[model samples]
Target: MVKDLYPSRVNETSQIVRRQDPVIHNENARTEGPLSAEEIDFYEENGYILLKSFFQGEELQKLKQELDSTMEDHQHKEGPDIIKEPSSNEIRSIFEVHKDKSYFENLSKDERLVSIMEQILGSQVYINQSRINFKPGFKGKEFYWHSDFETWHVEDGMPRMRALSCSIVLTDNYEYNGPLMLVPGSHKWYVQTAGETPDNNFESSLQKQEVGVPDEDSMRWLVDQAGGRIDRATGPAGSVLLFESNTMHGSAGNISPYPRSNVFFVYNSIENKLEQPFSGKEPRPEFLANRENIQPIQPVSNKSTARS
Candidate 1:
């Protein structure tokens, strides 16, 4: 359901696109599984994997134009998931794009990503969420260090930690540009926090990435136990990172002159899917927790080039 895009050049369109299937076939890259055994091993042991120059040329360009439209449309609006920082036009995220737009929807369904999911989770995997996290220049807010699974498990009924966060860099990420920071191998230790989870809402989720911010002492202890090796993943625009959902990760506020943006997708195993919400209440909004469209993704080819 995308329009007027083919990978390069800035094209403008006012269209709400949809798609029938996910496409992994790339002209510049082969359709076979992209990750190596060593990479998989690293992801398993270190809790994250960063692949530089993962996608480029027309694909990146087309996605950027689509994001350009999204950023413009949702900057200060109120609807679905278009979340902005507390009192400003600076956006925090545009959630569940795969449900509405074709460009993001196709990328989320790409075979390259799903094949990796097949390796990590299983053959039957569906996306839990999809959104572009906007870390705008100068004024982007910070995300506290916490495990995503904590909130997913406690609030959204996710049963276990069998999920992963795959983030594709949209803008060049640098040390000074609010790069995502990860405490290596921190997923092994599930830290229990003292703080309470805020109510389920876009604002709450934006203000607090973690369900509960583990106290400083708790976070310090967890870091010490995890070997105290923190890694800030900084790379070019096309870099792709796959991180364990349980890994303790966060990013500082962006003070750089250029924006740091990424399209993030969370994939959860069908078998390790969410149980009922802990509150015994109805599940969260579909944009927040997608449990109904549990169908496994099927890989498709790019019927036409991404460029027009």
Candidate 2:
């Protein structure tokens, strides 16, 4: 059995656990992809990198079209994958996007993205999870601060921190639009939150997470460790934010008139395939944590017809 390096949701009191893995797996190697040595170093020191204008013009429009189609296709359908806002009917998120075998699947396989994943992870990677988050104006709910690795480790059986999330901006993400906020350098430490895993936690956690989150004290310490700096990932449409899996991040409720949306893809190294849940419960549904049909994606050329 693989040792659980980071444990959460098993204690009455929350504590900090130092990360045992490297943020950048292969720092010495020369990167053949888009990211430079300095960029890799930045991601190592901090937890995320916001690449502005990563996709613009026609390439970006295509993604937007796909996003629209996805929302429309599943607007009325009821399932665990389609999460709605707490107080409103607006769709909050659409999970298992890559499995849809549509434009999103192609986006996941694009060589530009896959190559970067391979570079940072230092191995072939597979889609651990994929989703599109929607935060409509005024009614969108806030996602509380928590490290994704914490939930994935305790609930979904992810074994290590060799994973990262890529958020492709589908709409303008202004500061007032509830853009993602991440604490710099917090990814180096894992926050073991207070709580025992309840049965079918994903059902409720998907809409509003109450468990597997850091306490106020833990959040304060993490912010102090980063010199009390929290970064708001604000950018125009077509920007991309790549963040570490263990990064402490969250977003506020959107009160602005503008809506915020983004496509999220989680890439996990093949070496870090999930096992039995560390929380001693059944694993989350495949839509949330994929266990079967897992295969490393090949890097292919960008297929968008219109060039930026």
Candidate 3:
């Protein structure tokens, strides 16, 4: 079934990757409920929302464990020096390693996450893509300011509409830790630049110098052009930032001692189709798999019965 999706791209010898179950068993943790009406309004208006303490305690620890294991697995096989330090160039292209069942299961089964996504993007959301971002200390690359959806549409021929992204901070994030930065409410303008590019360049330019590093003044000017509403998003471990794909955003290089890692899940309405496969290798099997396994948000039935 997976092979059929890639008419000309499939490698016959490539191993079949198993899909993860969409349920996680964490006895010590409780699920966080739906977002308040105010929270939903904030997301709709500003194009992003920082849910404080979104994941913590045991569940957070479990995710960290999984992240660590995944990192270690990659490091052992690829060698420690695969990523050198003190550069802000991020190591992109890590999907093969992220295809593990545990990673997908952990992300998909988060009840609170699904509830919040449903509230923001409706009940029939489809995960467009998922990948792990590893930003090594000092050596991590600086991601320039741009909209995720704009780059997607340009490169993959996808349309720009109703796209959403959820970034789960697997490690502690602060200004020095390469936390994501954004221009608040920039999604409303739908700005596009001539030479803007996506940050998915890992092997070729991952460690290369930024082609055009925007100076502070230039960055401020760009923010002003986008309406002068800029903000840096930083939070505790397990914090998640949900934003529209068109939100203008970027991240700095990690200046801290430790590497900053995060997992990004991009979702769009199921009816939306990608112009090309996310990885450019083959179509995601999950996109064609059983939709029942992927939980949909429960609809709100009665306003009168709703709790104040």
Candidate 4:
């Protein structure tokens, strides 16, 4: 049985537990990767780093096309993997995308992405989850503030905070368009929310999270720890935001004319494979968390190599 170092959603009162795991496991003794020493340091301090224009021109265009085409392919389909908006049929998110043999799968194994994931994880890694999230203009809804690690630990049996997410912006992330926002340095502490895990929580949680989210007091406390500031990741198309798993993040509703969309990937170290749920319930569906076929990604040498 895996020992639960970070316990959450078990107590009546929310507790602030100090993080036991390092934010960047392979901080030192690393050789080659895309991140500079300074950039790595920034990620260590802020719990996130934005790479502006990480994909551009041809690369960006191809990703956009693939995103549009994938959405079209799923338009008539319905499954546990596809989540729709609360009010309309507009798709909110499509999960487990890396499982498909599509452009997204290729992007997942691109050396540029895999190398950085390997460096931070200090070992071989595999996709914990992958999705293309969409927030359409006028109807886009808000995502409440919460720590992903809190949910993954209690519901999905993630043992530690050795995972991270990369959100590749597919459209201009304007301030008003519900771009990702996070409390800097929030990853240093784990906020134990007050709740018991509901059976099949992800079914409704994906539409509008009610149980695992941090309450108002906890949110204030987390922001205060970061000097009472919330940072928004507003950037042009092709920008990428890499954030730690425990980082408290969410986005506002998009009432602007432009829609917001991104291809998001979660990578977990092979050493931190999930165990039985800490919630004492059955694990979430395979579409939400993968325990089977957890294969390490083989990084390609270049974009052309990924194509091959």
Q: What C-alpha lDDT values do all the predictions have?
A: 0.71, 0.88, 0.54, 0.88
The digit string of per-residue lDDT tens for model 3 on 1-308 reads: 11222121122221212112111111211233276666666765677888877777776776678766665666534432244333433334344232355555446535556656655554456565666667767566677775665445544334435557788887777777777898876665543332333344323333452322233554465577657667777888788888887676887776678677777777665544455533343322332222234343333332222121
What's the lDDT of the predicted structure labeled candidate 2?
A: 0.88
Model 1, position 2, has a per-residue lDDT of 18
Clashing pairs in 4: none
Question: Which segments of candidate 3 are over 4 A away from where they belong?
Answer: 1-33, 76-93, 96-98, 195-222, 225-227, 276-308
What would the TM-scores of all predictions be? 0.83, 0.96, 0.67, 0.97
Q: Among all windows of ten consecutive residues in candidate 1, which has the lowest summed lDDT?
A: 1-10
Ranking by lDDT: 2, 4, 1, 3
Writing each residue's lDDT as its tens digit, candidate 2 over 1-308 gives 78888878777999998999999876653466568888888898998999998998888888898898899898898888898765666787899988777678888888888888898998999999999977788776788998999998999889989999999998988888888999999999998899788999888888778899899999999999999999999998999999999999999988889988899999999988989999989999999999997888986677544562
Q: Is candidate 1 or candidate 2 better by TM-score?
A: 2
Q: Which sequence of candidate numbers ranks them by TM-score, best first?
A: 4, 2, 1, 3
Which candidate do you rate higher for lDDT, 1 or 2?
2
- For candidate 3, the TM-score is 0.67
**In every candidate, how many clashes are there?**
7, 0, 11, 0
Query: What lDDT tens digits, residue by residue, belong to model 1 across residues 60-137?
Result: 877788888888877667876777666765777888987764778888888777877877764457889999877779
Alpha-carbon shift of residue 2 in model 4 (angstroms)? 1.1
